[model samples]
Structure formats: structure tokens, C-alpha cells
Target: MAKPRIFEKPMGVRDFLPEFVSKKKWVEKQVEDCFRSWGYREVITPTLEYFDTVGKASAIEEEKLFKLLDGQGRTLVLRPDQTTPISRVVSTLMKEEPFPIRLCYHSNVFRAQEREAGRNAEFFQSGVELVGDHSPEADAEVVALAVEAMKACGVQNIQVAVGHIRLLNALLEHVVQEPEMIAKLKQSLGRRNLVEFRESVQSLNGSDKKQMVLSLLTMKGGQERLDQLAKMDGGKQVAEEVTHLKAMWHALEDWGVASRVVLDLSLVGSLDYYTGVYFEGYGSEGYYLLSGGRYDRLLEQFDRPASARGFALKTDRLVMASTQGPDHPERVALVYSRNMRYEAFQIANRMRRQGKAVSLFVKESDRSFDSLAGYDRVEEVIGDGNL
Candidate 1:
């Protein structure tokens, strides 16, 4: 006889039990409700897309993508991010639509992560994109919506750290002239390695520029930090970026979420498409629950350039942080003898119509009454139609 073969799921991938799936679905519904209430209509994009199209709009390296060749030899990839694919859809298909299009989605995104990190190879993301709007109000509106989404998930101790890529780019323009050197400086700052960042700044041409860059790496707080940055020596562009950020801060305050907002100049988004204000929400549990920013140039890649901003919440992380288990709905199991099958089903249907979960069980099978110990109620159907 041949040996039996065992099958297993790939690394960094997960299989959710019923309880976990229930909690995840609950979280998704909450987030989707929040998005819909804000006038964001749901959109669904393909799980696989042309590598060329997705690659052009995103900063994800090719190595991290799960690539495959179709029968016609065309290269395709599992989408690593939702924003790029959605951008392609809007730019090419919905070109004639009205501006400031609001679209939302709940989907699974695939990415390669280190095995030891215990991260999922596939993860759920729920987000919304506000396209064709570049005003400070748009930026503030997205951030405020992110706050509300987190609240809907029952996530507490949330902090949405806001930063402007323009401010960082403006400072770099004054200090670092070499593209490679600028890239290195950004990498160092992104890693929070102040030592490397300081060393890189030391090579700059001017003390004032070096001081400004160093100050920015540590500048994080509330409106006071913005006030201090406004007085820095980053010239015209930096001043404008700072002014824009201050305006966004006021807008966030107007939305009544100023208390949850924090100013963090050192905060840089992982993607390069972000052009202006970017923010990421962190929970007290130390998980990054949400991330978003303005990607004004992203649509240009698809031949329909327009200003856009959005955020994607990590639904798995939110569920893990907020829920203990499935918390399944109130359920009753209706057991029936052979003669009472019809009555048992009728009762089950009636209970279901009354907004209760009912599980039907026939007697003398593998499943016994003991198997229904978890149910809220277990009723035996008698031939006389009485429990």
C-alpha cells in the first residue's frame, strides 16, 4: 500500500475557524457601514491583475509579488495593495464619471512577509478612496472618517499620527542634493534610526539645513509642533506645506476629532505614491490599525491623473484587538425523532423567521444532544407538536 499524503496550507497564510470568521465578518460589517454612511459606495476589483498596470501605480517591489504567467504568456500578479488596482479601474473605466468619486472596498490583499513575523500572507483590508479632491478639507475628512471607523470597531486608545510628505521632501531638497543620499536618509528616518539619519545630515552643505532636518526627525506633538515647524528654514515650499498641515489640523478640529490627532513629522508612509498629508492609526495594543495618505500622482500612471486620498484598515488586526471570540448569536437546537421530522423543521423555520438561529437535528444519528451543549437552548420535538 502507498503511504498517505498530508496536505498543508502555505506559510504566512491562515485558516480561520467558524468563531474567528464570525468575528472578522462582524468587524467588516461595522467598517463597511461606517464607509457607506460617509457616501462611499462599495467597489470590487479582481484578485489578479496585469502586473504592468499594478506595478506602475505602486511602490511595491516585484520580488514581493506573487507572479504567474497566463496561457498567453502575459504576466499577472495577486494584488499586493488595493489602492493601485482601484486607481486603474477609476482612471481607465470611470474616466467620464464625476469628480470627487467616493469608493470603498472590503477585500483580501496578498503580500510576502517574513515567516518569523507571524504575519499572514493574505490579509483583509477595508478602506475607502476619495478621488479627485485635493483640498485640505478632503484630507481632514478622510482622517476623521478613519477615526470614526476605529471607533466603530470598538478600538480604544487610538492615535492617528499625521504627517505631510511634502514637508519632508521640501526639507530634503534644501539639505540633500544627491538622489541616492536622499533615499538613504529617508530609509534611515523610516527605520527610526536617528544615528544614521544624523550621520547622513552631517554630510549636508549647510548647518541651517542640517539643523532643520534633524529637528523634523524629532518634531512630534500637537499644534505646537506645527507652529515650531512653520518657523523653520525650509524656504517657500516648506512654508507652504507647513501652512497646509496647519489648515488640515484646524479642519480635523472642526470635525471634532482633534483630540485623537497627533502631529508627527517623522512619520513617513511605506509607499512612495503619497504626495502630501499621510497618517497611520495605532491602537493601544501596539498594532497599526489603519494607514492612508494623499496620492495625487498615482492616477497619472493610469493616464487619468487626479488628486486622491484614502485609508485601509487592517480588519484582521482590528478583530484580534477588539473581540475575544465568535460571540455567536443566540441559537436553539431542535432535536426530532423519525416521526417528528416535519414538525421539527417547521419549528426551526419559525424560529429562524423570528430572528433566532436554529439548528435541526434528527435523532439516532452521529450528532447527539450532548453535541449541542454550546447551544443556548435544546428542545426535543414530540410527535404531538409539543417540546
Candidate 2:
């Protein structure tokens, strides 16, 4: 007879061992505590949702969704993002809730990332959604909360790169009338491809438009950059947007996180649903830790058109960036012979009551006590009932 084969776990999936799980839980607790302190309540949504519902509002590509068919012949997908599903819940279920509903969630999302992307197919996300408020204060509150969450995770040397989608949209609307051309321009800008962006803008109506497009590609810094943008033609056209950004800056200052903020106008978000200010947080080690922005129109797909903004922290990446290590519990190994089994149980119970982690072992096993490497101390129950 042929030997049985052991099947391996599916690719892009991971089995988190206890040590890693402990660290992840620690990070989650810190984030949840911070969210609670800020008046955001925890909410949970289904892992599987209708493809049509999620696809209508999310920017995830159809091919990248983990899709299936329900018993009723309806299409279903493992949620590729949380914000859309949460929006569906709020719009359909919590429609009557008070204005500016604050919700926070810690859940895993599924995405079929390309193999070369080196990203897991399933990863955890911790985030918040501030619904029904359109003010610049809402935007600033989300950003500030993101910063606090990062600090809570023990991440240092953080920088929050703030940008306005309206700034880029305004510039594109001014230079390119054709939707196709504008999309190409945005694609180039999103990739930070200056040469390609410059080429795309070369067909613009005048040198002024081309220069403005080229300038925005590199226009990122502190208050000076904002001042310079305000003086430009593109910036002047969207003066109201600039004012909103300024108000957000002031709010960040009021939160005492202004020193960590930088104005990076070229920082366009990947999601098409974003309608206004968007920001991404980075750590000193060159990892993108968090990203979010205002998506005012997303809820309209569910018939609840309200202004909302929020951000999600990539928990997997955050574990890599966190300075804290996994907690090591002090463990005691309780060894026993068959005759001393009851005595061993009593000793273990006593140890447990004393708050010690006890690992019970039988001396009859082929393995020796030394084989248990992680235990800090090993006690053997002898025939005399003495440890």
C-alpha cells in the first residue's frame, strides 16, 4: 500500500504560532484602547459579503477578489476591504443612529495578491470610520487618532504625510479634459513617475499647465510648500481646498501632532472613492504603516449619502515595525510517574492558584524532562509524593 501524504497549508496563508499571536494581540489591545478613549465603539461585520455590494463601493479589482457562488446562485466574495462593508452596515442597519457615528474594527481581510507582491492573502486590519461629518475637523481627528494609535503600538520616528485629493483632481481637471488622458495622468502620478507624468502633460494647452503639473510631482515639504502651492495657478483655482487643508493642519497642531505632519501634495491615494484629504503614515525604517482619507460618496451606493473619513493600520506590517517583543511567560514543568498522578494534579493546581504556568509531563514517556526546553523549571513527583 502507498504511504499517505501530508497536505500542506494553502499558499498565501499563515499559521501564527503562540509567540507571534501574543504580540499581535498586544498591538490590538493598544489600538482598541486608544479607539475607546476617543469615543469610537467597536463593530464587527461579516467576512463574506455579496460581491456586488462590496465591489460597488470598493476600489479592489474584480480579479483580485476571492469569489464564490452562494446556494442561491448569488456571487459572494471574502471582503477585500473593511470600510465598504462597514459602510453597508451603517447605511442599512444603523441608518437612524446619531450623526457622526464613530466605529472601530479589528478584522482580517482577504485579497488575492500577486505571488511576487510578498504580501499575505489574508491579513489583519485595525481601523475607524467617522461617519456623517464633513468638516475639516473630522479629517484632522482621524489623522490624529492614527498617530495616537501608532504611538500606542510603540512605533517611533513616525511621519504623517498629508495630502489632498482635491488638489490633484483640480490640477488634472484643469490640464486634461479627456477622462482617458486624466486617468493616464493619475496613473503616472500615482507611480511617482516624473518622466512619464511630464510626457503625459506635454500635450496640455500651454506651458503654464505643464509647469504646474511638473511642479506638483516634486512639491512636498513643510509649511513653505503649502505657501508656495497657494501662490501657484493650480492652487489658486482650488483655494477652498487649500483652506480646508490649512484648517486640518491647525487641528493637527491643536492635537500636538503638527510636528510630525508634512505636506506632500503628490501623495495620491490608491482608492478611487477618496474625495478629499488623504494621508499615509510612515516609520523611520521605511515602512508604510497606515493609510486613510475622506470617502464622502461611498455610502451613497447603499442609499445613505453622508460625509465620512477614516484610516486603517496594517497590523501585519505594524508587528514588523513595533519595538516591543513577544511576551515570555515563566513556565514550570510538572513531571510525574503513573502512581503519583493525583499528587501531580494537586501540585499543578497549587501552582495554577499561585499564578504560575505549569506544563504537566509524565515520566513514563520516552522523552526526557530536558526535552522540554522552554520551561524555566522542572519538578518531578517521586513515589514518596514529594516534588
Candidate 3:
């Protein structure tokens, strides 16, 4: 194999120059402020975690994990997602803390890409986890916070699609008795392949049962869908789940975010997790901005049984779509003749105290002006007086 070029970088990673960093940071600040207002405190975890623990629990595809061996020959993985690592912290370090812990984080997660598919191997996410809450209100809180965070980021036409996994599961259990077929149907929905889901439903024997299975795809729009669910014959279990969704929706209305959220029963994006009320947030042109839901079983897997839910914002994408990037600090150039270098330092020091960014330059024989391009204003000092 040939040596890699000097400028070559690993795929699915990005380099954020100064200007780009300004925008990314701007977006972060906006969302961070929104989170802080909601009483969520930030938590951070190590970039690499034990593969057997966090890697397995992360819910990210195994093939997407970037794994390596530690010095002890133990397997480690670049954390593919933040939620699992946070769960580990809550289960271990803060296990004794009181119920309903609220934690937030801004971190970069790594996922290995087999082939470059125009997706990042590493990305930034800002999110929160609310633990030890089982009420539909908890789910609605996350959904509302997701909308507020998106709005704080200046997302246009923000819309959230909400669904209850239990409802889907109950409907499936009522229709499809075979576990294998049920898993396959859910996989199709998790992948957002409605056509595949419909095809799988058609394979079932009963026409009425097939139609009921397909309602996960068709039953969407708004509260009307919830009302329709009440009138349907989806068994007692399905009615309970539907009632839970309706309660969650009313909670969203209490938060005044109902205008921005709509029902999408087919919104199951990977049904392996989330007990109920999962949602995906979208910006202009339906760009996926964030996602979150209830995961009452995840903590139990970590040796702590607690109801929890949260969402992670795609910070990089938010930066790209942000309406305005914060402006860089105004830069001042303090150029000085060789003999008056001492005077230049004093002036630069004063400006620094005044919250100005100062760049000091000494006049040489050539007097080249190339470096002055980035300065907003310039001042000069000759041997005797200012020039």
C-alpha cells in the first residue's frame, strides 16, 4: 500500500475552521441556554468505553461501532452514542441520587462507516436524559423540549412526528402471533420502509388483521388519529396504549407545543427500544433535527430499574441550517517600528483589557502587508510618535 497524502483525512470526519467553529458554537450556546432553563445539568463521559458494556447497550448497529484494543488487551469502543454512557454513569456513580435525575451533555460520538455514504463517522450531539419518570408527562416534556431546542436554534417550520411503540407492538401481537414475523414487520418500520412493512403485513392470513397491522402506517395526521384509534377494534391492550398517547398529546398541548407536533403512528424508527411515545423532530424541508422517546427498560439493563427518556440534537446540522452565525470578535492590528516595540506592547495590553482582540506586528525592512488582511483596524507607532 502507498503512503497517504499529507492533506488526506479519515472519511466521515470534519475539520471546523475558525469561522465554522463560530457557527457551531453559536448553535450550541443557544440550545445550552434552552436546556439550562429547564433545570437540566450537564454530564460528560469518556470517549472510549468497554465494548461489552456501552457498545452493546448503545442500540447503535454493531457494524457501525469503531472498536480497538486497550493496552490490557481489553476491547474498547469509541462511544457510538451518548445515552448508553450516561446510563452507565447514572447506574454507577450517581446510583444513590434521588429519583428523576435530569442530566444533559454535549459530546462527539464515533461510528465507523464501511464505505463513505455521505454520512459522518463522527458527529456532535446535545441532549438530556430524564430518569425515574414513567408518566406520559415525561415523554411530553422531552417532546416539548425538543421543539423548544429546535426553535432556539432558529429552525424553520419545525414539526415533530410522534408515535407510541407499545401501541404498534400491541397491534402486532393482536394480529401476528408468530414472534419472528412480528420482529420482521417491526424491522421494516424501524427502517422507515413503509412499503416493506405493508408487503410484510400482506403475508399474514386475515384480511382484517392485515389492515389493522397496516394502520401503523396509515393512522397519522393529528388528534383525529387518536380519536380514530379509540373507535377501532384493536383489543384492550391497544386501547390502553392509545389512551397513553392521547394523554401525552394533551400534555404537549399544555406546553403550547401542539401546533408544532403531529401524530405519525408509523414513526417507529427502530422498535428495539423505547416503551412508548417516541418522536422525530424535523426542520425545514423535513431535515431530521433531533429524536427522543421513553426507554423504561434501558436502566434495568444497567442494573438500575428507572423510567427514562431524552433526545439528542444534531448540532452540526443545526449549525449548517442556522439563520445567523455569531460574529467573530473585532480584531485590531498594532503595528510598530522596531525602535518603538515597547510602546506597541502597552497599546495592545490596554486593548486586551478592553475586550479587544489584538495582533501585534513589528515593522521590518520589507514592510509586507499580507498578514494584515484579517485585521479589522490597524494602528502604527513610529520611533517618536504614532503614524
Which candidate number would show the highest lDDT if scored against the true structure? Answer: 3
Once superposed on the true structure, which residue ranges of model 1 sit more than 4 Å away at CA?
A: 1-7, 114-117, 175-180, 202-210, 323-327, 365-368
- CA lDDT for candidate 2: 0.85
Each model's RMSD to truth, in Å? Answer: 2.6, 2.8, 1.9
lDDT of each: 0.86, 0.85, 0.87
Q: Is candidate 1 or candidate 2 better by TM-score?
A: 1
lDDT of 1 by residue, 1-387 (tens): 655456567778888898778889888888888999999999999999998789545767777788889999999999898999899989878989989899999999998877687878899999999999878999999999999998888887889998888888887776665778789888886777889988988987778768767887678888898888788776899899988889989999899999999988788876366889889998877878999999898889888889999999998889977733344667998888988888888888888988789998888867547779989999899876789
Tens-digit lDDT track of model 3 for 145-175: 9999988888889899988888888888888
Per-residue lDDT tens digits of candidate 2, residues 84-123? 9999989988988878899999999998988788778899
Please tell me which model should have the higher lDDT, number 2 or number 3.
3
Using TM-score as the measure, name the better of candidate 1 and candidate 3.
Answer: 3
Single out the weakest 10-residue window by summed lDDT for candidate 2.
2-11
Backbone clash total for model 3 is 1
lDDT of 2 at 153: 87
